[model samples]
Target chain A: MSRVQAIELVYLFCAVCFIVALKGLSSPRSARLGNIIGAVGMTVAVGATFATPGLHRIGLIVVALVIGTAVGVPAARAVKMTAVPQMVAAFNGVGGGAAALVSLAEFDRGHASFGTAAAVLFSTLVGAVSFTGSAITFAKLQELMTGRPIVLPRQREINAALAVTALALVVWGLSDRSVTAAVLLALVAGVLGVLFVLPVGGADVPVVISLLNSFTGLAVAATGAALRTTLLIVAGTLVGASGTLLTRMMSQAMGRPLSSTLFGALTATASAAAAGPDDGADRSVRTGTVDDVAVLLAYAHRVVVVPGYGLAVAQAQHTIRELADLLESRGVEVVYGIHPVAGRMPGHMNVLLAEANVPYEQLREMDDVNPQFPLTDVVLVVGANDVVNPAARDSPGSPIYGMPILNVDEAKAVVFLKRSMRPGFAGIDNALLYDPKTTMLFGDAKDTLTSLVSAVKTA
Target chain B: MTETTLGLFTIFVLSVFVGFEVISKVSSVLHTPLMSGANAIHGVILIGSIVILGTGHGAVQGVLGFVAVVLATVNAVGGFVVTDRMLEMFKGRARK
Candidate 1:
């Protein structure tokens, strides 16, 4: 067999492995296996390339591998779970950047088809944008920068100009004097990337990251096309396709179009919380003991549990599930209310719950559960803040103005599990705390839920 | 330069780079926001692909451009859609 063909075969295996890895990642239980499968495939592909003809400079490659491992493994191992999304974004961006760089190198070495060069140019521009943008995104997510939406003065106009400039540079590159034009295009694209992300609110990072991951994959595919590498093409396409699908699912959960959010959403006018807690209408915030909450649940005919980031932080999913089971045994109906943007990423709550063996069917989206709130004898909110806050509906000037929220307040009795009365990710106080029907059971979520579960049994 | 070898070399080089990024978490902090922010790059891909389609290229090129446009659109629209939904969270309280 020709050496190139053999190498191709190895790449095909790697591509297959990437597909498997992606499939594994679809479910949390198999995500680790998926990662391993992808790694093994990549190893095989690399090994096969070593056997290719004219690859005599193997020493540099070996050194590169050694150095990469020395740096990568320890760094990945040391990252905290909260930083997982940031790590993924950076890695994805680098993948895109590397692909772009490789294609650029290939273009510079020789051969010129406007088509191929254009492809490479597009890839490089996007890849660089991804690299820098992801870096900034990581910073914001890590709280290195304020997680608030940073709106530069005249951001829209500046971004529009950058976009136009990038486009002009690309066209100029395609027509003549490609190198300088390409470099200019790259810079413009980089600036555009920064502007595009800077104005976005921090709450959207998960969806944004997933979307960018897809961008990186597509850039890699473009680079693959530039080089005519079948494996890179296939691997890139798989990632691109899967990432797009996931992003779509995430968008639908929020009941809005992605475009609306992209162009400086009107959310600030609509969904913000109640202004100043001293409005005095519902001044008396309800407070309760774990035992009181357990008693209320024990006697309730129906209970809906809403889990949020606090639940993830407290690692209370297992206990919450146990509490659900205990309620179910007494013939009380139970379900989980999952907000679209709960926790750090899309489906973050789902992932945690699934890990705790919570039944998938028990979880309901905001729209589905909102209607049922009035009939619910009890709505037990565990670590949820802004999504359920009534301020979105009542407070006109609040940051989260006009956004739809779960009707947790509609329930006959509402129980909140919280550490304190801190506002949610948006940093606004919720009026739900002071509702007449509401009761706050303050403590660590896991410990609180466990005690609530035990208290329910005796009640 | 009909250097097919160069293309092959690029693949290996890129693979190494990909492996490096995946293994190293030095830039872990940049992942999510970067991912979100970088998504606009897909629009560039979309625009480029559309431009190619409109330029009356070869049949093969046109077909390829069309596919790229489709894929790029999916990424662009899908990315924005998901991001918008997530952004909704900041507007209101996070419901449980």
Candidate 2:
């Protein structure tokens, strides 16, 4: 076969592999194989691209590959699971930056049809937005920037005006093929992306990150259209479609619509109202010792663990697992109640628990475990607040109202391991904390859990 | 639209459907890995960067292409490896 024909065939093969790889990833049992399949496909695609005839500058390609491997491998290998969301955001940002760079370089070569020009501009705009947006998300998750919504006055109006101006520049560049217009469009979109994400509260970041991931995919697909490559278009669209679906699912899990997440500032407004002196602090809370909590767990016939971002932050998954095992040894049944939006990202709590070797069957979704709470004997809520708030169901005036929660208050007794009475990421007080049956054990989650393990062991 | 653009559009639309169908069944427990895995797939843009760099373009384009190649490569490699590391942790009752 000719070189071009051979390259097309390899691309086709790689695309099929990617599809199968995604299919394999639908289940945990097959996910490892799926990852290997994707890696193999990438290797084949890269090798085929390298073999294309008339390809020169081998030294530069080798240098780039060496540098990338030298940096990428260690960064990936060294990242803790709790920071996986940040790592994903950082890697995605670089990918978006790369797409924008590729589009800029292609535009400079300047021999394009209207379709190619429009596609290049589209890629430039979307890629630039995704890059900056993902960077801000990384900063927020890494705690390099405050996770609170950084709202400037009249932010929405400014964002709209900027978007409109960028669109006009794209159209202008399309007609005149002006490089300056294209560059300006990208810069404006980058600023617009920052503005768009800045107003979203930290609790909504997973949804925003997922949306930005889709944007990067669409940007890559646009670059594919500009270059007339089927593989880039297919793979990019696959990620775009999947990422969008995942975003929708995550938002649904939180019981908030995607539109509200991006624009409503719901969490920010609610927390601001709750920040009053009469709010969280004025309420009475019952404090308990580790020995008390230990006795509560040991004597209970059944215990349910509700884990949240705090559990992940404190790196207490292993300690919690040890305590659970101690309980299980005494013939007290134990299961984990996982909120759909728990931790910083979807499925985050499950990953943390899995790292601690918690059985997959023991991790139950909110819907599955909500009805079981009333039958539960003792509910231990670790570093979770908003998801279990009774206000979601009882108080219409509460900000998280109408959002489905874990019904932790229904349990016979509730023990909360927390650092303080401060509100969760949503910045609203949880009525469940003051429930007559609830006892608060205020301290660092890991330290508290460690004490609980020893206490339970002695009991 | 030209035939080439039309063909591209067809591929894009079909790929979207394929993407939705393939990803629809993913369990909630695997959502993060599924996301990171899909994120890695888009790193295919590295091919476009490499193609650009191969043609021996102007100095400016060369510099731009090199950066693109490096960034895309980092994205592709880091994304896949990190995803693999996460999936490896998903082993069953045998692991513990």
Task: Give the best candidate by lDDT.
Answer: 2
After superposition, the stretches of candidate 1 with alpha carbons farther than 4 Å from their true spots are A254-256, A265-459, B1-96
DockQ of each: 0.04, 0.54
lDDT of 2 by residue, A1-459 (tens): 898999999999999988988888876667879877987888899899998789888889879978887888899999999899889988899999999989988999998789889989999999999999999999999999988667776666787799899979988999998888889999998998898888776767878888988999999999999888899999999989989999987676455678977876533465652354345423556676676577667656789999999999999999999999889887788999999998889999989999999999889999899999989989999999999988889999988899988998989999999999999998998877776578888999999999999977754
Q: What is candidate 1's lDDT per residue for A1-459, written digit by digit as tens? A: 887788777777776676565554333234345545655665565566556555442453454445444544454556565565666565555555555555445454446576678777877787768767777778889888966566676666787788888888878877773666766776777777676677555656666667667767777777767767667666665556555655544443333356544444323432231223244422655566665577567667789998889999998888999999988887678999998888878899989999999988998999899999889989989998988988888889988989788889889988899988888898998878877578888889999998988877865
Instruction: Score candidate 2 by DockQ.
Output: 0.54
Model 2 steric clash pairs: none
Q: Model 1 scores what on Cα lDDT?
A: 0.63
Model 1 per-residue lDDT tens digits across residues B1-96: 457645655654564444333322111112232233224222223323333334323555444444444444433333333333322322212112
Docking class of 1: incorrect
Span of ten consecutive residues with least summed lDDT in model 2 chain A? A273-282
Q: Give me the displacement of residue A216 in model 2, in angstroms.
A: 0.7
Cα deviation in Å at residue B39, candidate 2? Answer: 0.7
Comparing chain B with the reference, what is the TM-score for each candidate? Answer: 0.57, 0.92
